[model samples]
Target: MIQLYYAPGNANLAPHMLLEELGVPHELILVDRDNHVHRGAAYRKLNPNGLIPVLIDGDLVLYETAAICLHLADTHPEAGLVPPLGSAERAHCYKWLMHLTNTVQAEMITYFYPERMVDDAAAGAQVKAHAEARLAQMFDLIDAELAGGGPYLLGAQFSVVDPYLFMLARWSRMMVRPARNRPALGQYLERMAARPAVVRAFAAEGIAAPFC
Candidate 1:
């Protein structure tokens, strides 16, 4: 059986949601962040960065949230989590996935954990405010994409990208500029929250309702 080491609501949530979407049998190995289990030597051996998620499948050990989502989608193509390889839609998948992981999510990290970036406690508020402003613009770009063709990022069809997108959107639920504050993003997120996979993932991850 595949094993996914995870901490609830972390980047691991994306893969957790996808696994639910794929309807695969996998083990959830919770890495206790409160107790520093993820930071321990054993966990570090599994992931040098001491990340919350480390996917163990047969002989392959995968880290990185987007990489894991891609792997699960590729391994089970019948689930149709991604567009067909070499297709135009497939190219867009790659584009948005990279943008999510490298750009949007990176900005989210700064928004939530400004202490990591700023030295002074007072500066942390400024850092977080700046990140929230940047995220508003970034999410607005996504809303623009939706305005053209949406309900999902790929429009009509739900892709693996949605899980990562949903995860990031959920992160902003408590932000000063929460996703639900925007009309397009609010409707899009509500739809995602109602998905069976997302519902199941929330239950498994022990995340309570008002999931979006």
Candidate 2:
């Protein structure tokens, strides 16, 4: 059975949603993050980076959230969570996934953990503010894409990118200019929030309302 090491509302949410959407049997191993278990040697053995999520599938141990999402979608191609390989849609899927992780998620890390980059609390506040501003622009671009694309990121097809985007967008709920504040993105979030698979994932993660 697949075992996923996770913390509630962590990056693991994307893969968790995909797993629920696929209706696959898997084990959820809650990481004791509050006690710094993720930083301990046992957890580090699974993920040297000590990230919140580490998916163990047979002999394969995966850490990165996007990679885990892609792996699940690829393994369960019948789910249609990813586009046909080598197609333009697949390329776009890769593009959005990359942009979400490398760009949006990276900026979010800065926004949430600015103290890691700055020496002073004041400087950390500035870093977080700037990151939030950049995240707003990124979400605006995504909102425009949805405005033109009609529903999902891949033009009406619900792919791995949707849940991934939802997980990231949920992090912005407390921001000054949240991703949900935009008309198109707000509607998009509501649609995602209504998904049965998404609901199950959120519930499993013990995530409360205001999910956007």
**TM agreement with the true structure for every prediction:** 0.97, 0.98
CA lDDT, candidate 2, residue 30: 97
Error of 2 at 28 (Å): 0.8
lDDT of 1 by residue, 1-212 (tens): 88999888899999998988888899999999999998899999999999879999999999998999999999999988899889999999999999999999999989989999967888999999999999989988888888789989988899989988889988988877787778888889999999998999889989998987
- C-alpha lDDT of all candidate models, in order: 0.91, 0.92
* Top-TM-score structure, candidate number: 2
Worst 10 residues of 2 by lDDT: 201-210
TM-score of 1: 0.97
RMSD of each: 1.0, 0.9
Model 1, 129: alpha-carbon shift in Å?
0.7
Native-to-model Cα distance after best TM-score fit, residue 204 in candidate 1, in Å:
0.8
lDDT of 2: 0.92
> Which residue pairs in model 1 clash with each other?
none
The digit string of per-residue lDDT tens for model 2 on 1-212 reads 99999999999999999999999999999999889999999999999999979999999999999999999988888989888878999999999999999999999999999999987878998998899999999999999999998599899889999999999999998998889999999999999999998898888888877688
